[model samples]
Target: MHSTVILIEFGAIILGLGLLGRFAGRLGLSPIPLYLLAGLAFGEGGLLPLGASEEFVAIGAEIGVILLLLMLGLEYTAADLVGNLKAQYPAGLVDMALNALPGAAMALLLGWGPVAAVVLAGVTWISSSGVIAKVLADLGRLGNRETPVILSILVMEDLAMAVYLPILTALLAGTGWVAGGLTLAVALSVAGLVLFAAVRYGRVISRFVSSDDPEKLLLVVLGLTLLVAGIAQQLQVSAAVGAFLVGIALSGEVAEGAHTLLSPLRDLFAAVFFVFFGLHTDPASIPPVLLPALALAVLTAGTKVATGYWAARRARVSARGRWRAGGALVARGEFSIVIAGLAVTAGIEPALGPLATAYVLILVIAGPLTARWTEPLARRLAERRRARTPGDPAHGRPAAEEATEPAPVPD
Candidate 1:
């Protein structure tokens, strides 16, 4: 595309995203659904004929995730990473494994080849934390006990899947690398990444990056994001992985504030990244993969709700908390599609893209709706439990007392 055309396209993208953001806010819905609706409207399906390519839009979506995950990583510490493993490992190991199983079986039933089924199944195992986290924060559940457990699982699963995605795609594409002790290489690389993050970038960014200056801080963040991503590419892992580590390392208070310095930048990139996703799909030629995409959406989202509920129950949370967990796990946003795109770039197959997109879209819509109403849903179940247990503490307590209670003292 010519520079003029590129500039014009970018300008239109900005305008469309701005409008959709406003519209979504008014409707009390996530802007993602609206952005996608706009994409369909302006894409081949509509009269505008913007000629957006799923491949290109999707690629931008992946970059957006890398940036977002980089932010997420900024929130972690070494013990937290280990704590994530302990808190999240079993649930994630089980949830993702079971989730993929059904998806693979369904794909095989649909007569898809094993490779396609595997790729599709892997894609389905993904859940959208972006949408989930947003809704949790919106509903004031971010610091809740149940929320942290769900988030821990999400973090572990995302980290694992990020690495697994490229490997699986390479495997399916017959790319000769995994065979040569690639797992060992990955493990070592991750260790090296953690070390580098701590020793090289962790302690000194405040001083070395001249973070006292606003412009300098932004440059520091942007530079580190790209730098780590580039290094990940050379290591055959993922730049997003490195970026996430950056986030984790930096999650500490670099300065005294309610929100970190990265807040505006995070919001800006996140909007661009997701809006870019919205701009990617062409409704006129809704790819044939949309059907299978919807199928995987049902498969994955349904499985997540069920599994998350079960996990929350095992953790001995209230029925309402289980429902919250279910709602939280319903969406598959940036992380899901990023993994899918990685598969394609690794030469897995073309069909996977549409399938992942369809599922991701479904998850985005379903996740927030579930989260938005989860409190009411939780209350209903709590009421039911109180009814059955006659004299349940929930009912026995005065409303004012309950309001002052600190979440039932968390057992």
Candidate 2:
């Protein structure tokens, strides 16, 4: 009877997710926010809370996080990471300064302590890579010149996580400085070793993992990722990071094959991960934090836009591209929840999880809209300014149009 109930409940959840995804698709929106809402509806203090399938969902959520990171790693080679890190380090620093400080300040203002402040800082700091990638692809902006600048910022953030997560893990565990320091050192060493190996032996690793048979390839890759992730978790280095390194280690045909085969699995598990986050968060807890979350969301949204604008401007992208870049960077999805979930699991401030939830929901939905409209809005505003100051000849023409104009065909 218990097994039967679990099956029924789990089946219902999956079916509901399919409907939500389809609904989101028709609206030309990312399905993440919908998945999260569904989780809330079925969570504690919700319309129809689940009991039998909770454990299964929890396990699936963990796998989701690992697969998410693994797929992200597959998108870039070691050389790409290094090149971006070198060329874009300054922009990355600017991004951190602009985006991270607001969350830390908000946490401090709330008296959540330094640790919670650090966690909140991270929650706000990183943008949703998965959502942004999809948006760029969907909008046909992948070929845009400003896209590389956007991608560089994201790569730097992901690389920073290899360092950040271990420290966060140690802190959440209430480890001493010595222990934390040791954990960070181990994490850095492992990351370095993985990168080194990837650069030097990536092709060899790919050949080893490569198989002609799709089923065999999928099983080998998935099993290897899980094994590495578990071992990394055991070492306090983080399972996601371990899986990411495994993705980096495999290159060429193996990485491409693995990505193709595992994408559906990643999507399924990632949805479960988002749902698991919402499942643990009490819907009742949201209202109290909603106001503060909204305020934070507004402030951080502006900051993210600023961060992207500055990065793109530095890259010498045109005005429209800069606005688009800024707007594209506004969404906070999986990483925000992942960071908050850690703190929630550690029983940090009860309100933190709710606040993060509200914050992410607002931004995730707004992100796509902003990406689509920010440039046009900026242009309209500029036109109004020019109309107000007709004498200002520079503002007479659209900045994008002026930037794109061919150097008046030399006579």
- For all candidates, the clash counts are 12, 0
Tell me the TM-score of each prediction against the true structure: 0.81, 0.96
lDDT of 1 by residue, 169-224 (tens): 45655756645357437745774666466645665653454456666677777777
Please identify model 2 stretches exceeding 4 Å from their true place.
405-411
Go through the candidates in order and give the C-alpha RMSD of each one to the true structure. Answer: 4.6, 3.2
Window of ten residues with lowest summed lDDT in model 2:
402-411
Model 2 lDDT per residue over 96-182, tens place? 888889999999999999999999999999999999999888877887877888999987888788888999888898999999999
Report lDDT per candidate: 0.65, 0.89
Give the lDDT of residue 394 in candidate 2: 71
